[model samples]
Target: MPNDHHNAPQTGLSYYGLSLLSYLRESHPDLADDADFIRTRAQAAAEAYSCIIRSGGSRIEAAEEADTVLYRGLHFSLYGTLANVIRSEFADIIPEEDAREAALILLPQAREVARSYELADDFAATPQYALLYTELTGTVQILLDNGIQ
Candidate 1:
């Protein structure tokens, strides 16, 4: 009986949820490490701070807050994964710390550039959006090349 270990509840955490929780844990280590805290309080802090049921802000404001949370969280996760991959890929030539530091520096700027992209007047055109998209891609390309070189 003491050695049996088959009754544990499974928590099939999704990629997005895990990323959100990872960010919350990194930003607020003092918070309790539990599903209840993460789902209600920590999640609200990361994903609902601007749209609390009693906050009384406009719907647009709440939507913006949600967008901010989702975008930033995705960016954080993207950087984290990229750094890990770069470090592993260039293990012989690049130190893990250096690769991670480079990623940390570039990710925010890349995210800003990405968010700046917007559609042009024509339905099929996205000149400004394409420019920003290329800029972000070039930034990442530089990071990847330099990371390996």
Candidate 2:
């Protein structure tokens, strides 16, 4: 059979990174400025993912492998760095308990958002994508507000 996946619109780590950067730009401009960092991680993860697919690994296996790469790269860049920045710079603004809670809430949600982009060809164009963006931003805003006073 022909390679249908090739014909389909790009749906992989690189596009997922861009989608993530777009979301960060809207919700967290500071992180968005780290585009080079994000792109490098995403590119490395994408290459690993493609290699698995080319090696005839099952889609599930490939995705699992990709997830490992993403966790080490993308997850660290976004969440780990955010945590460090918040703790170092804004620890006075946010309480330890609230920061912990926010991490618990946002980490999985953010992973879901990234997974959506990884799997969907045009996730950004979908209504659900908008809803996800709103929800994620709202959560961040609420956390910030709670921290303020």
RMSD of each: 11.7, 15.6
**Candidate 1: regions farther than 4 A off:** 1-40, 43-76, 88-93, 112-138, 143-149
Q: How do all models score by TM-score?
A: 0.31, 0.37
- Compared with the true structure, the alpha-carbon lDDT of candidate 1 equals 0.49
Indicate the residue-level lDDT of 46 in model 1. Answer: 45
> Which candidate number has the best lDDT?
2
**Which candidate gets the maximum TM-score versus the true structure?**
2
lDDT tens digits by residue: candidate 1, 49-131: 44543498776777567546543423334354445545655566557768766555665655565465432223124345445
TM-score between candidate 1 and the true structure: 0.31
User: How many backbone clashes are present in model 1?
Assistant: 0
How far in Å is the alpha carbon of 84 misplaced in model 1? 2.8
